[model samples]
Target: MSVPISRLHVSHDAPLLRHVSEHASRTDWCYMHADVASAYHPCFSERLLQQMLQTQERIRRNLAADPDPKAGIHHLVLASDSDVFNLGGDLQLFSRLIRGGQRGRLLEYAQLCVEVAFNLHQLYDDRVHSIAVVEGDALGGGFEAALCCHTIIAEEGAGMGFPEVLFDLFPGMGAYTFLTRRVAPVVAERMMLDARVYPVEELLRMGVVDMVVPRGEGRQAARELIRRNQRIGNALRAMNTVRQACNPVTLDELLKVTNEWVDAAMRLNDRGLKTMERLVRAQQRRAQAAAPALTLV
Candidate 1:
């Protein structure tokens, strides 16, 4: 059964989440739309993560094998529900991983998500337009995922931010690099460091989101953008030319920066882990206490 966005989890089975395992494997321009019906519950299930890794590997192989690369996919649009895009990783599971001394596994999980983010970025770099239709809250890894896309389209009521600092942690995914690329460094810094939540208008002002559509028309607006881009054949190739002409930092270098942050997160075991544990516990208590009042409807 499809769980409510507030109740969904990686551990909880939903056909859509299970379907993500097979999404990246399909070649020939995947016009993907992510409508995470249940937003707050982001489990990062073992099965789904494993499948995502496999699918990514398949994409890499396909990209490498293509003798003549061409622009594919009209565009990939990730759609969200009425209130939020994604609430991010399931903190309960994360706390379990941390408490169990499964740092290696946790890092591996984070790295897989990192790889996915980079792959998405490369797809955009190659001229395949990827759009994020954010209708609700997009926090932590969810925000990182949205940043990986080429364009972000949100509705008027949307909220986007990174609030992981409260848990004594940071977004181990590609939030740092992606945010810096999409918006000004100062704005990204404010978001990450201050854990500030930006409203739709504010995000638009900063140029983080390309367009703000009507409340329920985010998906339609995104597809329109994709269709417009599709009219230009070899879109990705043209974008690559511009990138080369501008002499921007290479993808390999960006990956290096992302990995350095991962390494730092991995090193947070001795004192850092203990500190994080306390912080997370306090947060969990507050969330648990407030759960009944935090209604989605």
Candidate 2:
């Protein structure tokens, strides 16, 4: 028997939830909500990432148990809070890791991120559609995470970009791989090295964003897109499969870049880490300011 999704507990502390509705359809949208005022942003903690991984595993198992394919989740949507999608990596963690010379731990984090990027990019077996809903700023690793999805549905005022260059490091998890797949390598390189935050509209124009909707409409747009595509779902999946076969995003490449990232991280001087620390403080401030009406969905 299929279990009720609400009762399906992947992790008690996962800071995410599942709901069922017509618009939700065969879609599993997990919205992350947590206090940014905490030293660690909800999205970038080791504990949170582990919970998320467990949740995905559980979801996959549940889907496999379900006999009806259409009744199962056809799409997975990642939603975030209203003000900031994510501030990227936990700067505090990075600062400590870099200073303490915790190379292995840093690599582990990178590997975790790669696993996340690859699994989402593959759409959990290519049978499930994947969409990223960006309602606000998605920076650095956060932007890379969004790009890993098959489609990025962002609000009109949402923003995304790589600010990693400013900190003397690159977004080595999946930015280069995903962005290059979507655009030219030169274009990807320029975008990353420039360190500018691009608006959702500009990204939509550049073909980076699949859809841009009004504020508070990202979830609606994602559901609507899935519904519209359902008519030709078979064809859509077939085309994506063919594309993957032709030019696959390989794990080897992800690991290679991640290793390079760790090495570069070891070379960061005080100046770079200071910049990262400042960013961390900025996140804390944002969390404090938005605490009253802050929400994730």
Candidate 3:
């Protein structure tokens, strides 16, 4: 049976949710990103990811049951939350979901997204390229989501990191696996442990972000990346493959380490802990400042 698209706890009081309901286009940026006004209406919504994953899973099962050397599409460019990319899983909403005996459903959604990430990783290993463009802050699960892409393009001052660590929680969406792969193990650890928000420039220098562009020009630069680097993506995929082949540790072995970290994170309690309060408040301030003003529908 095909997996069902899991429902999200979209707040009825949220202005953005209302915007989504009003503006015919909710989250699909397909033709618009390409600047084809004619193709605008068919924009890719977050629903697109769910649709793509379900289709891919079906095809994958068919292939595994048989064996097809040739299958799958070539390129896919997805737009994240307006400037923020994604705020990861809605922790506030998640708290309510978990309390409602819906943790399994949430877990299922997380697992599906994680599987999609694995597919992207394998695509990179098999010499296929995927690009993710970040226009603003990509926090917690959002950061992990971007890590799944082969090429990550961020805005000049964009913020990126696994801030979930600050919440006394571990990344349940495959952030550990991808972060270690993209940046040095030591550097990734430092970011995870400290739960600091680093600038895109720092991330780019550390190899966490592939490229940084000026504000309002990130999408343009990303398109140019596709134009200029014809074989660059393929080359990167091959390089990653070679490195994995040469590595002594297998993915299974790495997951064990990740589990240990998860266990430790679960034990943490940010309740009454002011450890990251300053940073958290700062982020909140920025979010409030940048948030588009609108009354709830």
Candidate 4:
């Protein structure tokens, strides 16, 4: 069940927090939050992906039917939980799938991830701009998910990285695809392979972060950015279109790399699996601790 902004309501099974903020008759912002405290910890679960896809389609249709070029689903901001933005793919799910030799299930999960990321990346073309307001941690696929947005507005002191290399696997999602867009290929390599969480400032300097606001101001910063964009929305949208056209990262490209991720995950030996298992426990613990502050409603 998807929420209709014109007639707003949250589905009983919707994984994320959905809220619509009215700015004016001209613009409406739909904020879909990452609101999960399970092992997924807002990981790209199948449920979350399906709900988000349905929401996106609904917003697109609403906007398309409007007469104003900038009318309908003008902006999409990916908000986060009170703390961590996301910890990455569901490590526990991966462990189970790999241990059970369910390679197909694992690949299907990766495909779902790709579909969400690729769809968000494609939204810039529809006059629907995507921004990720990262307030806390965004690691591995978490970082990749942020990169999918047209703009990433992060809070100062927030951490972001790809720690897949720690377990002998690589972040095969859109990490490289998106990172290289703002920085050099070599620099992108360092961030992924180092597996060390980098400070927001470092990423800002490296050009990965479009804007870094003071801590606790991520959502406000995102809104300010949106307001500024709305002033010259047409120009911004056109430039975004040109930028995307010049260096397009297609769904095919992401799918190819994600499949490679599946292969690497499948080949993980005992030591690597142990490392992954450790992360799974850590993620669950983190989620449990953050539970009091979380609510899907």
Best-performing candidate as measured by TM-score: 2
TM-score of each: 0.71, 0.88, 0.63, 0.88
* Clash numbers, per candidate: 8, 0, 6, 0
Which portions of model 1 show Cα errors greater than 4 Å?
Answer: 1-14, 18-40, 43-48, 51-73, 81-83, 124-127, 244-297
- Per-prediction CA RMSD (Å): 7.4, 4.8, 8.3, 4.8
Worst 10 residues of 4 by lDDT: 1-10
lDDT of each: 0.58, 0.75, 0.53, 0.75
Candidate 4 lDDT score relative to the true structure: 0.75
Deviation in Å, model 2, residue 107 alpha carbon: 0.6
lDDT per residue as tens, model 4, 210-268: 89999988888877777787777777678767876889778778888888989999999
Model 4 residue 110 distance off true place after TM-score fit, in angstroms:
0.8
lDDT digits (tens) for residues 37-62 of candidate 3: 12111112234335545444544454
Q: Which model is ahead, 1 or 3, in terms of TM-score?
A: 1
Candidate 3 C-alpha error for residue 249, in Å: 9.8
Lowest summed lDDT over 10 consecutive residues: which window, candidate 1?
1-10
lDDT of 2 by residue, 1-297 (tens): 112112222345525333232434667776655433333354466655555565566667867777766543377788774466766877788899999999988888888777777767774555677789998899888898899888899998878999888889998988999998788999999998999999989999999998899988988888788888777777767766786888888777888999999999989999999998898787777666676554332
